[model samples]
Structure formats: structure tokens, C-alpha cells
Target: MAHHIWRRSLAVAAGTAALTVGAATAASAHHCYKVDWNPNAYANHMSGNTAWMPLSSMGAMIISAPAPDGAGLPQCASYASVAVDHWMAETGATSEPLIHSRATVGSGAAYQGKTVKPFAYLQDSDYAILEEGLGMAIDQCMADQGA
Candidate 1:
């Protein structure tokens, strides 16, 4: 009777340990695929804008942004050019991603009755760099307009 009770207790303990390990594994797996967004970054940018969300843990969206205006496609292209230049200057050639700009005419919240030339950074390290680069580009544009 004593031997049987001991065996039963051992079996229960083993089952509890297995369950605990499984639960821990599942939690870690879930954490890896979670999508996090930075509200501060979202608030600072304009209407037609996308970038790596600030303060994210792992994984980032393919960097992309819609052009500013529909009628002025060249203006949008120029803006992307300037932004890329600023980004390159800040991050250098080795760290900077391949910048691509393309114009697309569409009607939506971000692009309503305008041609938006989207800018994409192929390989960027973090949101901070992208945000700074974007801010610099926009500032340059503003300065040009002011001049």
C-alpha cells in the first residue's frame, strides 16, 4: 500500500511539471510574433506616412510611405530623393537601405484624389533612424519652400 501511494504521487508530480513546461513554451512563442506600434511616432508624422514603429521589440514592416500630393508627382519624387539623401548622410552607405520611390494614383484616406509617390527603405535598422531621416527630409522640404 505504501509503495502504491508513493508511485501515484510521483506520477502526479511529473504530469504537473510537463504542463508547466508546455505553458512556458507557448508563452514564449506567442511573444515572438506579436505586433507592436509606437503611438508617439504615429502622432508626429503626416497623413500619408509609414515607417518602422518606434519602440518595437522584433520585426518591422517593409518601410513605405505614400506621396504627399496627387497633382504634383515630381514634387513627391523630389521629396523622396531628398529624404534618401538625408538618410544616407545620417546612416552612411553601409547602413542605409535601398530607397525606392514609385507614384500611384488612388483615392483613400491616405491618398484622396491625388498621386502619391510611395517611398520604401529596403533595409533599415530601427525606427529611430527612419524617423530622424524622415523629419530631416520634411524639414529640408519646408526650408526649400520657405526660401
Candidate 2:
């Protein structure tokens, strides 16, 4: 009976150790910043030279290259624009109408001929509008892509 109890205690200790290690690993893997406006709850991985995120089933936002300053807001905005453009192209067929409407009326109005600054954009109400429009477009894009 003593031998069985010792074996059970050893097993419990090993299990506790494994659980601690697993929790640490998961915590470390969450190296992204969450976006409040994004309906998909996308998180921006701002580590290294490039900053990007995934948009649910729609697709991923991949920066072509890392910004010079690494974590500058302006650079992040620039990269975001590029990534959005790429997403637009990939989903053009299904998203053209929505994108065009936005360009003519809604969130796109704020973006016309304007350089995007991440901080300023976030502060603007137009940011939420743009996010909504973008979410719609992404949904259509995903449907078109058979995803």
C-alpha cells in the first residue's frame, strides 16, 4: 500500500510540472497586440522588423518588409495600407462593389489622398467605419475563395 501511494504522489507531481510548463509556453506564444475595432479580434504581432495579423478565415495581413524604425506607428500604418491593398487585390472579384462603395461614400472617403497615421486613424470615428467595411469585404472574399 505504501508503494502505491508513493507512485501516485510521483505521478501527481509530474502532472503538475507538465501543466506549469504548458501554461508558460502558451503565455509566451501570445506575442500579439489585440485590436479593439477588429470584429475578428485580430492581434497584431509587432515583433521583429515586420508587423502583421490574421483576419479570421479571410486571410492574413503580411507586411512586405519591416519598417526602418521597427515599431514606429507611421511605418505600421504604411505597412497596413500595403497589406490591405494586397488583400483587396486577392479578393477583388468578390469585393469590388463593396470596396467601390466605401471608396465613394464611407470610410474610404477619409483615406482619399491622405497619408494614414496609425494613432490619428485610431482616434477617428472613421476608423470604426473602415473596420466594418473591411470586415464585410473580408467575408465576401472568403466566400469567393471557397473558405
Candidate 3:
């Protein structure tokens, strides 16, 4: 009985290890594919008129679009988070993920004395910040283009 129990335990451990390795392999195999978007849909500058903006991440290049009126920063963050959640949903890039999202935005740190609001949601109770640099880059792009 003891030997039988040991064999069963070993089998279970082996099974768990195999499942973990398979999941990791699948995830690593995931790659970004081609996508299409209207170039005009993205904002060229920051304005009272909200618009979609792009953010870069490790998994993909994402976008942050304006939140509905009264949705505030949380909504903007959601826009970014969702884009990263699915990656290709908001990007036009055809290559593997590139760019490290980074920037200093409104009431945040200093980036050439420009601080724009972050467009992507980087932090939440359920997950750590995705690519903060992407958030910053989005804000800076808005500011630079607006200027």
C-alpha cells in the first residue's frame, strides 16, 4: 500500500509539471499578428477633444482612447488596459511587441517639464502595473503632438 501511494503521488507530480510546461510553451508561442486601423482615429495632439492614442508594451503596442464624459481617469486607464489585454486590438504593428512604455504625466514626475494624463490603466487591485513607460509615452505623445 505504501509503495502504491508513492507511485500515485509521483504520477500526480509529473502530471502537474507537464501541465505547467505546456501552458508556458503555449504562452511563449503566442505572437502578435497584423491589424488595420484608421490613421485619423488617433490623436495628433492633445486637445479638450479626447481621442485615441497609442502606448507601447512588452506584449504589444496598445492604444488609449478617451473615456466617455464623466468617466475620468479610470476610464482612460481601462482603454489602455483592454488594449494590452488583447494586444492586437489597438495596434497596427505586425512585428513582435516592441517599445517600453514610459513617460511622466499630469501631477506625476518630470519629463522635459511636460506632464500629461496617462491614457492606459497600469495599476489595479488584481494586477500589477503593465508597462508604465507605455502610459507615460502615450501622455508625452499627446503633449508633443498638441504642441
Candidate 4:
């Protein structure tokens, strides 16, 4: 079940990264960015005060869910922040991460219109590494940003 995978991934992430997995209602620092589901594989850009992360629609919903307290923001913003940081560092990008300027021009666009796949249906163990990696990445990003 998706809940099982989510719990497992969270556990693995916490253990490996040694970071507390807090509620979706994160701090102000995590609110620095917003996510936009798009056709891009992975892309990020800063627009004014908000960092925008563009990913597949499914990916966006997974990370944008509200906290248990029903707050507007989610802790998964950390994941997006860390991912953007790594992409920037890996590509030596001072401003952008991907060459494509359009957010909805890839094959992923076909499925972008579908209703967000619920977390209960997102039960794929194969992607556990992604969750774990994002967890560690967030920790690293936090340290790098002095947050």
C-alpha cells in the first residue's frame, strides 16, 4: 500500500539522513519555494521571492500535500529545495537548471491533466531511493543555506 511505502521511505530517510521528519506545516524557511507540476523532468527557477520547481504532475502532488494539521504548506518543500540545489550544483548553473524554458512540452504533458494520484495509490517500492535521496538532500541543503 502507498501508506506503507510512505512510512517506510520516511523511516529510511530519517535514519539515513539523521533528520527529523516533521509535519507538512513546515517553517517559514521551507516556504521559500513553490512547486509547479510540468512536463519538465526536473527544473527550477527563482521568480521574485519564490523558487519554482517544475516536475511531473504526480511528483508535484506527492510533495504538496498538506500537513496533518491541514496547513497550506508542506515539509516536502525541503525535498524540492534540496533537489533544486543539487541540480544547480551538478550543472554549475548560476540561474537555471534545464535548457527548456517551457514547463509543459514533454511527453509527461499527456498525463499532466489526470487527477493527482492519491498518496494511497503511489505504492512503488522501486522509487524508495528517490525518497531517501531527497531526504538526505534536504538535510544537506539546510546546512548549506544556514537554515
- Top candidate on lDDT is 4
Error of 2 at 74 (Å): 50
lDDT of 4 by residue, 1-147 (tens): 676556545533443332222212222122122223253423323232223333222222334444322211244444554544454455443543221222222324325764433111111231343345455554553445444
Q: Could you give candidate 3's per-residue lDDT for residues 1-147 as a string of tens digits?
A: 676555444433332233233223322222211123333423221121332223322212122221221112222233343324433333333422221223222323323555433222222311222333234333433343332
What clash pairs does model 2 have?
A: none
Candidate 1's TM-score: 0.28
Best by TM-score: 4
- Flag regions of model 4 displaced more than 4 Å: 1-61, 66-73, 98-103, 106-133, 138-147
lDDT of 1: 0.32
- What is candidate 2's TM-score against the reference? 0.21
Q: In angstroms, how far off is 119's CA in candidate 2?
A: 23
Would you list the clashing residue pairs of candidate 3? Answer: 45-146, 77-121, 101-133, 101-134, 102-133, 102-134, 103-136
TM-score, model 3 to reference: 0.21
Number of the candidate with higher lDDT, 3 or 4: 4
Residue-by-residue lDDT tens digits, candidate 2, 62-126 = 11112221111221222233234443455442221111101112234345765433211222232
Clash tally, candidates in order: 3, 0, 7, 0
Error of 2 at 26 (Å): 2.0
lDDT of 3 at 90: 33
